[model samples]
Target: MTLVYFPSHFKRAPAIFFFAFFLFTLGVTHFFGGSVSLLQAGESKAGLPYIVKKGDSLGEIALRYNVSVTAIKKWNKLTGDKIFEGQRLRIEPFPLHSYTVKSGDTLSEIALASNIPVSRLRELNKITGDRIYTGQKLQLVNDRKRTEKPSVHVVEKGESLWDIAKQYDISIAAIKKRNHLKTEVITPGMTLSLKEVPEEKHAKEKTDEEDPELFEYKVRPGDNLSTIAERFDVAVSLLKQLNGLKENRIYPGQTLQLRPTSLDEAVHVVRSGETLSSIAFKYRMNVSDIKRINEIEGSKIVVGQELRLKGAKPNVYIVERGDALWEVAQAYGMRVEELKRLNGLTSDRIYPGQELQLGIAPARPFGTYTVKKGDYLGRIARLHQMSVADLKSMNNMKTALIYPGDQLKVTPFLQQGSEWLKISEINWDDLMGSSGGLKKITLGNGPYYGSRPMARRQNNRRYYESARLSLWNTYKRAQKLQAALDRKIAKMGRLSDCLNGWHIVIDPGHGGLDPGAVVANLDGNGDKVYVVEDEYVYDVALRVYVMLRLHGADVTLTLLSPDHLIRHSDPPVQTFVNEKNEVYNSRAFNRGNSRSHWPKGGRNGNLSRRVAIAENAFKNVPRNRRMLLSFHADIDHSSPNVPLVLYYRNRRTGRPDRASKQFAKAIQPFLGAGTVIRGQNVFVLRNSPADISVMLELRNLAYTDHAWALRFEELRQRDAEKVVRGVVEYVKGKG
Candidate 1:
């Protein structure tokens, strides 16, 4: 009497027809959209074997639990809504279909709904830790008879033992133990004994390949198999097969067995054709040491196994009773500010026994100076190597207030990117060249800015060139910043001819239920305020759209503002928007898509719908003429020094598109010199129709200083302008 749920698209129409008829007979009718309406009721309660009290009816119970009356009736096989006291009913679902993990899904949540213990769930699935991928599959029931079903996998043409074991997410040692094979030799038509397979997929006559049907899962991180499958429009069950994951449980290696490893630094993931000796050779460590470190009994290793290399130590330190951040950082040859930043500490406070991550940052980028009596911002700026602005920006200072014992950061070597841009973005070299032709009597003694164009026009081009020499002498060493100031000579076309009618889609990552990287901060009034990912990201994206539109490019924003244009300030007015007001609107961006096409949902549904919007906007448009820039503020993983940028990973070869790579490089210099360009198989980039697409994590919001900047319009505008400027440079470079 267990009910089968079908996904949206009206799957199994005949079953749904009978279900509709059954509901009609019960004097209730229901409608469904986007596949299974039962999923809307959410996962079933783990509660089962219900002891029905007096006056309890199936309809009332269903209403209370937000489940369908039809589901309740079918689950109990009740002929009617009638019930009696002491009637033990099976309330939870019987395990049948495998559950695919999605973004933001937790194992405890899944286990509770499935009415199973967390420990038993781990044993049944064979996965350690809560790290499950989207599209991962999970087996819910504990039926030993399911494993007794001769779950043999027939060797395919040119298949290896490793391949078969990995395909089934079983251990090769377990296979060898089960089959009693000493050697790794096998032939076509030979069958391998697999440790696990679902009971429904086992067939005596079918000694063919792996089962066609499988279940994947959603995970907390959202970067799991289910999300991967959802992004690529492929079956997650198949990806599990590819990864040698059965029931969404990943063995240490796809085919080989591995001993448990500690959460320490210097772990190596075993690849195909690698053994202990090969891994030892790669890391230049002894094989005996490798075995001892990982606690392996033999030299045998498995593919995808995480082996701790020898002599590797844990990258964490336990705070002692007398240890302060300054003392600890100085002891480790690191800066105090960096230590605080790494641990996300807003104030310089420490407690004993608290663990801190020893980040891979090389000796801190900036030096710190302790404040003395009668010290002020101007005196400190001159005394230290950095500017007053740099000092204020780095410490998130609202005013020039400094205490006697305050440890202020001095970033002379350009740790703060925005302050450096303010000084270096001027055309210093061009000014040096023009200064040679200036008449001696034409210039004044004061510093000159070319802001007044009318005066220059009236003076017959003789104005301010003398002051250029004054400017030149002050900034003669500007060429040292050539790494960041690349493409200084390139023309950015005209403001009105941005790629001659290019179509751009600016997607602000995370919305609604996915608040993304939330941080509690304070506003200018010294009142508590919240900084959220969706709010600031939308403002940045909105700025990019406006800047691109001014350059005569067609721009589309995947999200709309409920507060309209009030969200984006021109002269940097609004500081922090705690509201999550950006809603999905396909028709709002491009006219081709309809308003009703997007459904109101949360979690990963928001991501998929953005990709759909990009695909629609670029339909029939030339691939080169379209680009997608997904702006997401990173927390925890981003580097303190530079922002993170990534392009799409090709599904087959695992390489980024040539055009996308070019686009990524063009914008990277503007973000910072050390900004890393990596490849992420993110759903939006992997699935977008546009060929040139990139996701930019503009800043590390994990640091309070960085998160504090997002609250103000000035910082957001700075981020947006740099991004738009980089795009223009990319277009110019292509030309």
Candidate 2:
């Protein structure tokens, strides 16, 4: 049976009832978590299909599978020992359970009930969203073994290892070892080895708890900390310390760990979005110390991966062919001595397959030497504390020849008043005050930075003072009020001068043949309705053009009308000639005559035209000007009510053209949230010489009322105003 779900109107009780029932059923499923096979049973030499009835239980499933009732319940993790009707259970004859979707289930909700994250659920179901309708087959966790064993309890919100251990009569340490927990702190979705445990062994294990063993606990409804603590016989403080929990409150699906002796040796779980540097910073320890303790070599950590803090070095790397000792050390983000000591290497030369130690190398002493023109290895070595042979050896150099660009590594003899200094993020004011400040400056390294020198040349970088005065009060007020907004903050003394006074052009999308969206009339005249996306766009463009021009910006259009401009020109098309262009052009050219549309007219319609316009606009502007923006309208053909906006990042030419992803980030939230996202490659912004170019999708005028259309027009005008405002801010160096 195919199950189709119509979106429930959230106003009624039936929807709420179904949703609650589904959650309840899922929660109850934890009891019978494994599978049973009927194929092995004599009951089914062939396949058989069974429909579920209201009063059926595990016994019926087992009978159907030719397996025992115990086997069926154990297989499916059914907590209530019962089943319902209109329910279809698969009799695979093999020990496997395939869950079928019920109404009102989201992927996140299902994943929570199944003791996993949405990612794992997606992997299991091969699904991307909570879009499953009733009757959809979903692969459940596969477990074939059947015993008198109790259902496995996963650590859920608000539960602790102690409670779980007591419930299952198992030792916390045994559970920890089974689940490979390093700390007493566990998380929701961690499966615990719950079985019929011996009381004496459990008691003995409890008495010895030190670095307590971690285990899983399923949270029961209405269970609180004080209640759970008394039941588990573990200190609430100990539990809190184990979980890094600040509050006593716990959720229904949270998992907590418990140990026998002392609280478990403190450890941290590397979570997603956490880097080793960040972890080290958070723990107030050096990254090297954490790395040394956890034995982690690279920055690869998946969410929920545990790290032991009991100080252990990671495995040493073996030197192979084409490996340089220093290079290898650098690869490990360490020094040669660190690598040598870790692997116990006593010599400079390392052959293929030679074992090398790996750990955080101890910090080295200060070293420095000035370069003497025309001085070779022997002279340079003598000036420093290193011998000629040692210098060559330390630097891994086979030759004595040194060039002007070569840096000599030397041991330093620190004298009084000698200090190392850097400009440390040059300030805009100071740089602007100096002559030729933007002329690619080299401080420590050659050609460190390249920037435009206009700030220095004009000596007008002081304009920031006035701009600052004008905006600071406004900014503080906005911040104080906590206005709904997006803000970008830059540290240090200077802003990007290259982005100032940028001349950008906007290209509104889908004009001419592309009569974009067709809105059916609610009236019963059989009257068809249509909106030429380009026409709506042109309205937007004219408003934008006037606004941008008023703000002293240079603007251009790719196409002025529905008639032939670049599309009808020779070379067959004026822009990006790809499949996307062809589709867009065909759509536009076909207009309302859907049948006469040219499928291959051009790929990525008007892309080339837009790019050409931007290119021309950029060339026409002064060398100091910046980027471009292409305007467009959202279209779904499926659901036009949900609009979309997208941008392009760096193009193939290595230019910093605006990324569509950024545009989507900037505008998507404004479109009423949760809009569908898509990517496109067009020519205009793609080919522009500007630092960045963006394509903006304004709105979906189809299916919109007259009021909505007016609002959309207003939004377009506001967006245009924002574009000019952003440009002015950029030019003033406030952005």
Candidate 3:
């Protein structure tokens, strides 16, 4: 080796070299440390396992990670866009392994080298076929080892090969290949190698007969033949054959043969637009069977989820708490007798957590069948080979009434004993008279209570008997009257009867602080006066309320006069004190912000509160006998419009409700000749709990004649009377 000597400043050569080395070392350290710190910060900011902070939204997080909100939701299985602080989210997709094509490398060769299925590789890269090019970067799923050594799974009772694969997050084919098994059958108490096994070595192993190892498992709670087969990675058929079982009946503490059988376990990954029912149809498996194997509590699943397509047997149901045999049969669309026959049930008695074997039968298609013209309940029932009572029970019908274009269930199972009568059995005379032993009280613009008379009398026993008889007589008379009215209405083809015994709820749109469509007008003194929509509608509603009550129709108002107190201030805002002693601005109610303003009963803000009040009244009344009418006055600036009626229709079917349309059409003639009955999906009518709901936009305040009519009490009374006539027609038509 030859050495070169430094000539200039030779005395400090060693010191110079030492200082240069120190500076170089410091620079290297700083550069590497900074790079590491930056990498860690980037990971913390937005990456896998990101800890959510306050004010973090899904959109913000998605933007940070360059991902879509939909992708994030899919990854997290979120049904809605709601997240809370401190919740951790997966901000990044799973890391993909990249493979660069080299010379002499083919797609199949690369996939084999990586020990991944060729189909999987193609799926990951979106490749159509075996086409490839050199130096191409192909994205691949990461094949990282889950564990250092493969873990052994002990066979359990009611376990199947598919179940084992799902538990270990491995494919059924992979498990079968690792165990050197031709079939998916495995018995309980048998130890199986989860790691890959050499085919030659597995072949060399002794057979079950030569080993003579006692392979038996005791059944436990929630164990049935299907579940046991799933737990042991075996087929239910093999278990039955080995145990000499003629049926799917199994009990706890029972011992069964633990031998492997021949069956293939198929795995399927859920995709978008797939439902449990559809999945079951694809696999030719019963929906309940699929649910049982997966231990699913509800019929909800997310995309990209791995599901077991095999090992699900048909007609096996695990009894849930509060489950009755009849209910179970109905849920499966099977008759009670058929269910009993399949299960060999001698009695209707069944307990919670009991497993029943519903033997496989040919699948029957259950769907809606449209009612054609001239079809009656009895006729349809006969066509479907069901009784009228059964048909009514299946369709939840309160009356034996069906109309053309109505979609009715063709093969729906009847619910056991949950039917309610359309009309109540009450004596009108006993309820209205003093001696008949029942008294009624007025509450909230309607009769509320009907109770036994409290007054003491010498003939108390006679009075009680007389009241009972009177009630029965009254019920019979009302039924007869309703039948007669139905026939008359059918013959007349018009509504022209008093709305007696009908329950009606009237909702006046906009009240209190919500002026609603304020229009400037001149008073008698030439001062500007504001004609608010709420005040006019309220006045008209009051008149209608009185008219309906006079005709013996039960009436309820969403907002009473006492609740519509207004204070004329500079801002012209209304205020009210709630039960909690909180003063809330009525303006906030109109804006639907009253909940935040009051914190108590604030949800009853403005329009929503009015809707809730109407719904509550409807609930208090009977279902078919109740109707809701919302009154509103519109201001049209473009053109002069006449009075119009609006009603809601089913959005999915695009068909207006028959009753609501009839009610609207009945009132149209009374409003004017040019009045139009429109189908509108308004908030009140669309969401009302009543069977029939209608909204009346009485007259346009912008028009001269309409404004004059509303301003005069006599004209308003005339409109109210027309409305009463329309309602009477509707009630008569319903009968």
Candidate 4:
């Protein structure tokens, strides 16, 4: 028997292979009788299969197949430099095909013919569009078969109709048609069809143009049902019917429907002492026409009876006291010329109780707008070139509070000329001084006067002088009192005083499954060991918590220990298992009040849990007296060796809270001379419920000095003391 000694590295090879080789050596070759074959170097092409033979190593086989040794090893699953005879190996890379474009062949058609995506075809040939020349050689990669059937996609939060259509490489019109969506508003969790519809089907789809104009009108401060109906050229009854309004009462910013009139009919309410001829004359129609339309037997009409007018009728306004023709025209959102033409008047003249035609007003130029997330009155006003006060007035809003899905009227009636006085140009100081400084005060002798008053009362000049002296003394006393109050406030703002009754929540960043930033170091035995960020921060957090508690602070810790394990009966505890087969305590990760269950457990779940824990801790405490301090360590080698105190500012206002900034500044000195205190929008800081939320990146773990300092208990204790000192200072200096 021929002895075949395999290398030591190949000792872990498959047992079946060794058995087959052993049988082959014993001349029992029936199993591989015709399987063993070889490909010559000049006979094989890339991606073709080749059989191995005796005396052939991976390098030799790769050379024979005109491929790289790495490729050969990868294709055959060879762990080391070893191979067996009769083993089949892939000697080539993926194949490519070159196709000449034929007549009437588009890029999409060609891709479909080869079962490839058009995107892949374009990428292979660097083609920008479908304008491919006939007979042009286009390179095509042999990719996986494309799916011909339609797919379904569930809508996620923050996704719009345009976004979904773009993601699927389809048209928005096709999605709308398939889903039968009348509007572009799609809610989260709604299932949407992503199937590409044919051009013919798209042509038959209902479009926005075919739908009636249905708009939402926001009630302005001075708006009523009559004004809204007149503005949109619809009847007040129609507005009430569409909006389901039982009464004409509407508040500012209240949304109302401005739907099209059904069947092109207008309803008219008969007033007292009104005849059919007079009504017809007011509507600019013949008396017989009105009678026939209303089915009247004679010229008689009942008061408060309803009348239906044929076709469209112009909105009428009963001229009120002090109303002019021009003023009435402007108030109804019409030009003076248009009003006269519609009313067939010879000149601009109007009087009280006279009906004036305000013709169907033109469609509002500024259309209605829906409130979205992060929308406020100030923002909406700025976008539409109006003032917040005007927006509130137009919407009849008593306050600035607006929620998403609330409709607002963007367009307000533009008044002709100056409707209100311009006071910004007036000099207020001059006016106040010229008005003789309001009135003068007089002091009377009372309990402070002694029994020895005997002089006669003085003249007017003496009395005025005495009054001025008394006034001066009162002003001086007021100034002194204010100064005393200022001094008291300053004394109370000290760090110790501030922390005395404050509820401070400390969040130790990363725990359990999340190691945060990690670095490798050598132990005494020269063995590699990992230094985890969460461990160091947790140690520091415990020290800070103890220090704050000693300082009379009501402290709450988000993560109580490194292992995150909590007692079974501990309130508000989240239970989880760590990588070391150890159980730990954590908060149940939740986004909102309703989402209590954890979804897609992993890094995301851990972070959400951390935030939830902090938020819950904060909520149980008083809002005004709460503060959150999150501790973390950085691992950036290139970052400067310094501590960082980060706080969040409102994105809309673009400024951090004054107290938060003061707290950061107070803690900076204790952290070190190189410490940085800045405003940033970190997740924890932004979402924390505390009045003051700040994050402290203790030190750079990657730096040798910082890393070495963290290893020693004494050094970490000293650092924790410094942090406590900073917190004390921040609280004391809160004023």
Candidate 5:
């Protein structure tokens, strides 16, 4: 609190001295490997060590180096919330929510340490395959706490945890953890622990940081800036900046980007000569990365298509024929003249051979900055080496319009701690393994719908009342994960060459804990006959796994043996139970002795038991390059229920495509020998994620008729083969 007033007579002298001292200090800083401010606004230097690229999203950039999009935007004083290729983004010296794969650390272990979901970890790091190798950089996406924190303010009269969390740029979880509170309630004068964090908590905290919640998105054929931005809660301007839009456009064969907090999600891009393997290699990523990014249950990438590349750097746009210079400049936030100058041109005329810079153009101003999660304008300036006014001027921002994916210009500086460190090389095979989004499109007229026919439910005549509730519950869970899966798959799908590479985890239901049906003693001996559900499912799953492997698919099985899976309270089951009783309608409970028989554990040898086991197994299988198949033996004693199959469908809305039902169709024919009924009321068959899931009921395995049992193995093997065939076909079409 010391204030000295300037003397009137010496005012000019003091001003001159101050100016000289400032200049001298600035010179010394630069001479000593420090940065000098070349910008009139924004921070004085870039902190993180990476550069934003074309097809890059704010979330991807943040996850790459374990920072927050908000922090990055704040540091850069970014307006319009955009990023560009070649635009330098600040990185902390050591990342908080990231790890360099150690020799023994599995993906699951890494995810656990970072307090992030395994699926999120896979998507954040663009892992296309299973396994993590030594020296691989894996991102844990739960580190938003580093960038976003609760603020500490004296509680006034009436305040809630939600209100407090909102007040301070932090989440309710953070506040609860900081204050050691049991619930989100607060009391006056309690001195609640607020997350009054610094500008870039993600960068500031270097160790033991949890991963932030992250989402994945698949690139679609007609995806563009506006559509993706709208879906993910991101600004269109920000998307353009992160992706380095040489032209504000996107194609079908590319991936998308996303974050936990961003409304508009993240995305990726497609490149020439890029296969799943190549894409994985270039990004030090995996084929699974491509699959996850593109949301291709089967590997498929159309020409000029856009997939999802969540964690990898945004893609670069190659100069193409019939392009305009102005369009390019506007897309990348550069002057038309700058484009001309960068390409050594005097006029606007351009050529394909010129290879105009597609991503962020070169020549960035310097500065030091920290990124914040969910950061907006007005807050970034306070934490960095720039003033708010300066930031506006430097970034050419008229208002406080900013988003998470912006890079700011700043003065240069010497080496200091950063959230990101430079990595010179990336090994693709070690990171992504062989899995991606390259599949063939069935343009020909032979069985245009592939193996399984659309479920009988599509006809809308035989919708089961109780079954609809059961299916809707399961479908809701899948839908909840759909957005995230889409983001991951889109990234993997862009590599057409990588289409042949696919890591597929297939789950066949009714193993271990689930015995679906029970039979009574006809002789009156009071002895009960238990039919084993696991036996059939185990056989089917194994065959499918083998067939898929033989067909060049990298396949993993949820239960290779009866004992491989146990009845567990996780995943689809958990999701179903969590729903309101009204939504969790189940016919099994209404069946005689169903509730008592279908408890949590023990091999009951019933169809319901088998279904539960399969469902539980799916819960255990991580959401990376995966699909779930609940195999059942149908039993409809009366004609009312008949013997038809069903596939789940999402309520009609903006999202189109039979993602759920198609999977059922893919495997239906193999099970048709028992009883062929087509329908769409099954919950397991709804519009779920790219971990394509469906329920296949072998027509009459439960019937006493020997014909049903005779066809059991045939149906099992065929179903397995079909699953494999479908995956292979998908890969071929995409590749």
Candidate 6:
């Protein structure tokens, strides 16, 4: 080694020069997207490990891994962007446990792809809207499911696959494949395992079959032709042609069919000067067929426009009010099974204005058949998949007697059950007492409770007094609550439409794999009943969602429950189950309520997913117009657990936001006596960009308290109304 002697001043100058040179190199490399960082020795290796080298920076690494730079900082305990050469860094939880937003990304897509519940994502990220942007950082969490016995279901009598699926919220396709079921037929006493996933997937659904995963795209607030087409992976031109769109206008709630073309059809591009007639002639098809398939009007054809050729439009029939599958099939002279197959219907449910596809061929002669030689009534009924009795009824035949030359009605009308008047049996002995049970109330020409003939004076009313008292008390409570709400609303003026056009998101707390809290007991009939936190909260959330929507606010739900399309509960949901079946709206609940299928993390990821969902959902709306209502129930072992309203506050200031406080106060009065109003920096609420975020703990599930609030449908409905009234009141105050 050669050594040069130098003075102390000169040596210090050389060191300073070298330090300056190093800073310059780093600045140039980072700005130009060049990797220059080198890993330093003794740096901790935690999370997904990475080594720094030439042309490496936080931004560059994040982009490569499709993660947010902030996430890298958090995982690596990084305080700044400065990284040294040879420094070992933690880059994990990046691609492995976190997701970065991409252009045109929706909360649903991220939830589905990452196997994290969208609600969990929203909760973690504190998202209030469905709108997400490119290059945003999102946290992923582990789906936490309680350990329990292996999930197995026994077939019950009178239960179909559809019924079982709806009850469990799992797709039929998933269940069938799991149990190796060859058809949708199962017998009682058969036990099936619902836990294990099939290694080999079944054949995918055809273009026309209704896909259980997703059948149609329900247009959202800001959807257009281009966005819808891209999301469904179809061409814009093809979408327009298939949906019969003459322009690029669509409204929210419009159902757009993604796949309508059959495998037999081919795409044909319209050349300049070519008319629909010319195209039909070239393809050996009729002009009418061309027009129908292409959704074309008149003879105008644009250059480079794509049109489906040789595609015949399947016959479509509009379902009128009160129309049933049997009626439609009978009118068209087709079998019910054939009609179901043609329209991809699984159940007998039909709503007014629903479009159903009829078979391609012309309808055969209806309600009449010419008897021929060797033809029997039984044979004709068998051919039509109808019962002999049904055929006889349609033909108005008294018996199976038939003549060879007689014309018989072939189409059978739907069987109607004879309406038997309901006879309510009254037990006079139990209702009346032998003594003077009704002496005071009975009408007579003598003193009220005093006298008459020995037999006629007897006023027996066994249950009359007690029953009357009980009914009177119940009615009084209901009347009191209604009056209180009325008085409250009257003070606020005409505010029925206060929520008009506002964006509201209702989130049910603790769902899917996480049941939150479980209270098991027996019902009046000695059958097991559950007051599950998630189940009860979901029902209440659904009720609020419906009420808000009816008030003209654009309302949506953070998670989806079984039979979710039901806006009104007919008999109301009186029972709660401890099934892990609720899913964040965009992903399958079986995707493990995201089992977040993620590697173990610090906390359950479901809430974060929910917060993220809310954030993205409210992203497009103004902060003032955005609101999130998270519904929950408390398990109180002591003390009266009246409804509790928690409003979001800033931790530093120790005070709630003005809007959130107002919202809480407006709702406080209606939430029953002793309604507690709290202001705190709640994780779910504080993260929301919305001006108002309130968490409503609707009921106290304790034996001694108001536990019936969870088990009684009537009580639950009342609670829902109370919360809705509060919201309306808040909007009124703002107005």
Query: Each candidate: what lDDT?
Result: 0.49, 0.40, 0.48, 0.48, 0.37, 0.50
List runs of model 6 lying over 4 Å from the truth: 1-496, 525-528, 563-574, 587-594, 597-602, 636-639, 650-653
Q: How do the residues 1-735 of candidate 6 rate in per-residue lDDT, one tens digit apiece?
A: 000001111112222122222221111111000111111000111244567777778887665443568878887889999887688877553123455676655675455334335677788788887777888877754325312322344454566887666645569997786665779997753544445532322224343332221324556677898876644444465456545567888776455554431111244444323467545644456888777654455765543244555333346654432244555665566776787667655434333224567767454444466775545554455334343444675666765657778887675322222331111121112221212222322322111121222322112211011111222232233233323322332333222355766899888887655666554332333233345676567767755765565555877666653312212211212343344445555432224312363111136564666676777777788768989898888553221224667888788976567677767756664453235566778778978667788988777443212333355443455567667767776687677
Least well predicted 10-residue stretch by lDDT in candidate 2: 568-577
Give the C-alpha lDDT of model 6: 0.50
lDDT of 5 by residue, 293-397 (tens): 443445533211233444323433332222234434543546767765555444343322123554465553456454434443323442232334445666777
- Whichever of 1 and 2 has more lDDT, that candidate is 1
All-Cα superposition RMSD per candidate: 22.7, 27.4, 30.8, 35.4, 29.7, 31.8
TM-score of each: 0.35, 0.29, 0.29, 0.30, 0.23, 0.32
By lDDT, the best candidate is: 6
Q: What lDDT would candidate 4 get against the real structure?
A: 0.48
Best by TM-score: 1
At residue 92, give the lDDT of candidate 5: 37
Clashes of each: 23, 56, 14, 13, 166, 57
For model 4, how does the per-residue alpha-carbon lDDT over 470-512 read when each residue is reduced to its tens digit? 2223223323332332333233312233367788888877653
Tell me the TM-score of model 4: 0.30
Off by over 4 Å in 3: 1-497, 524-527, 563-606, 637-640, 650-653
| Model 2 quality (TM-score) | 0.29
